[model samples]
Target: MARWEIKNVRIAGVAAAVPRNVVYTTDFDFFTLEEAEVFNNTVGIKQRHIAPEDVCASDLCFAAAEQLLADLKWERESVDVLIFESVTGDYKTPPTSCLLQDRLGFSEDCFSMDIPMGCCGCMYAITTGGNLLSSGNAKRALLLVGDTALRMGSMKDKSRVPLFGDCGTAMALEYNPTASDIVVDFHTYGKGYEALMTPHGGFRRPITKESFEYEDFGNGIVRAPLHTLINGMNVFSFAISKPPRSIETFMADYRIDRERDVDYFLIHQANKMIVDRIVKKLKLPLEKVPYNLEEFGNLGGASIPSLMVTRLRKQLMTEEKSLLMSSFGLGLTWGTMWLRTQPMVVSELVIL
Candidate 1:
């Protein structure tokens, strides 16, 4: 029998990247709360980080990866595999993970690949990488996910244009059977793809000037152009419904109590309302969920990792806490993972 129940890989380290450019809610003229009732009704978003126009999603991933590797004292050559999950990529051809491997000066022996998913990519990456390491094929792994999707639109689309901010996050995972407390499950609904996605630039819809025509999903709500049609209602419904189911599924399988066991619920940061609805539906206490949206907005794949980094900085997470983390979003993808926090040593130079 396996010495472990396949449930004992601790989180080694985590780091995240946000662009240097900070844009406050007041930066937009017509979109400002003072100017538009809709903006005011939706609530002020505070501030968000915008990547330099020249930077791409892979660049942000590299930045965060550098920080994470340094923080964990992981030598580039020691990384056996690199799993990069992202909805946005530098381009459709070369895998972003491979590009990052070269950018970060890693040995060619490293296994580099990319898993293309939207909001759920972070959880999926963690679950996948953890399993890979547990198999003992790879001892150490770097999981990086980020997006520069903010640049996906022109100045005309106000809804998604400002709400998204660029960010990248990396998690370092190491195999350790002695600790023995990791659980993960990743799922997807391909049918939900049309509900929230950048419908262009892929093989299906080649990028063209005419692809920029915007479409309204009823109720005078105009979202991105035809190339990118995101149905907020459908997306919201799925997000709210799926996360609780996922959590219930995990708890049932592991025979763990939800209320008594989970100390924190590190959910993906798609938006405030989405999170509120899920938390309510799950019947989880408000204090259990961490909030980074109020200050950073939604960083997509980078949400959970960034939130972890913030919580770690505040000493809010400790070895005693049992965390139930879930991520949901575009691609209609979602997943949940459970793990017991454990002490992991690191160099002081990591988070700078």
Candidate 2:
């Protein structure tokens, strides 16, 4: 792999937006204990937030960007490029990023595009923004991610309904002139596609009322017998093996140790069980892993950024901290990135 030289690129700010409405685990009372037991085994997800029927992924993303820009005190003009990552986009055409850019009042000269890569979306977005900055194509970039897969499912597909939620997160990347300050690495695996996917609703099988009523799969969540198929076991097996292997490989390749080296492990908030599994396998301390799944559930691509923003606002994060972030699952994709924290704001000094 050829290494690219990057100068002073720092994550200037971060923010996340979760829907006001949240669905609790108790909401699953509709499912029998036996059926729910089959679903909850290994893969631990109790509750997830769902966007209102009319709310699109872009809505969550835009709200997140608004809060992020305001918190950073950054003008829209400072953003030269924007990337929106989502599988559940606002539309099939007219990339969601375009709508978001306008909504955020970004300048006309800014370049905007959308990437639809599911769970790996955030990693791809981060890498995209980093390259855009290092290439001098843009001075600063905004990487936004959001998804509402749960709302996209039919009412009958209760299996996936409780696992996904609507959320949006934003990260600001700035170009710096110093070479040693900013560095990054990435890798991906796409062989895991069939292991997880929305079974219907696209060019292959158009939606129809009949499709909605069909129950060939013995489940009501189908348009033409639609089932949000997921091999829970496969996903967990790959997640456990892949994430740790990648992290260890990257650390060894970079010659870094966990003790006195990296400051944080910001894994995607996939679920409590998966998060805990990886944490135990890696033998990483709880403090090293910053998570908020209990409060927000799985926000898909928005998980990592949302956690970062929440921690920062709570004054739980500090300057010059080294954060190691890993993203995995969906498309069977995964990657690890090292970041240095340079907070956008400092504390206020008040007289007693």
Candidate 3:
């Protein structure tokens, strides 16, 4: 029930970058062709862009930020704030945002930090960036969200391997006194944290030799503690229930009429099943929710903005529209935000 509104901030542009390597679920040796097809029909993911071994989330996000900044023609020095949101940072120590700040050549006076989150990271980052602009503490902010989630799971794990893709996105927000307020709502269910998480590598359970030892997790799914672990049924159950309720609450709290006031619902590309379920639960028109899972799979926090650039760039660039975005995943966290977008520059997807 954490809900609030921030004003005087407008999204100026958005861009996304994905790896060039393409992986088809059917090509996975772990699953038979028939099984792959069944997974495709049930999970709704056909292919994914996998980052090369040397690539990290920051590399993809840097590409996106570079492209967006160039399209906006905004001086690097003018960016007053930068926020990097992801569970896959370049290192475990120094914040990834600091690395990006140096790479992007932003002024020393700029404020930069990192937010470690999964599917909901983009929404959280936007809310944080908007607040900074609203408080007049930043004139322009860069919200970068990306993840190399594909690298976190076992290639043989059917429960997670085929559902994740690699991507990074950049969203530029600027202080605009004439802009309308951005309304956002956030909720968390800590009890479900184990539903989706990597069991080791954190402070509580530091990585050890045993962490890398693979074990059969049944149903042909095998993974080590270091690899991502997903309780499929629990995650699916959470997805089907939380997002729809969160969206309804967001709309009701903001007094928004889906048919008349909202232009689109850019939901997290978790899977086709989850997206369809939420849409049906909320009784939303099919056309109002856009999806890119067929081509990109799930990009974690990058899914929303990346979906916007890939599927709705024309609408975003040619018309003024009201957009409601929702994301749910790791931390058992979920959030919704409502914002208005003016005709703005949206760059083509950058392939790294």
lDDT of 1 by residue, 1-352 (tens): 1112344466787777777788776676535456444542363356778888787777777877887677677789998889888877877779888888888888899998899776777877776777778767788888888887777654455556556778877778888777656776777778877787666677787878867666655544454444445566787789889878877877787887867888789988777777877788878888888887766777888888787776544443335567788888766777887778675532121221
Q: Rate the local accuracy (lDDT) of all candidates.
A: 0.73, 0.72, 0.92
- How big is the positional error of residue 144 in model 2, measured in Å on the Cα after superposition? 1.6
lDDT per residue for candidate 2 within 289-349, as digits (tens), equals 8877766667777777777766545443355677777778677777777766665532121
Residue 100 error, candidate 3, Å: 0.8
Question: How many backbone clashes does every candidate have?
Answer: 6, 4, 0
TM-score of each: 0.88, 0.87, 0.98
When 2 and 3 are scored with TM-score, the better candidate is 3
**Candidate 2 backbone collisions, by pair:** 8-176, 211-223, 211-224, 222-226
TM-score of 1: 0.88
Distance from true location, Cα of 31 in model 1, Å: 2.2
| Better candidate number, 1 or 2, judged by TM-score | 1
* True lDDT of residue 111, candidate 1: 90
* Best model number under lDDT: 3
Candidate 1, residue 109: how far the Cα is off, in Å: 1.0
Q: What clash count does candidate 1 reach?
A: 6
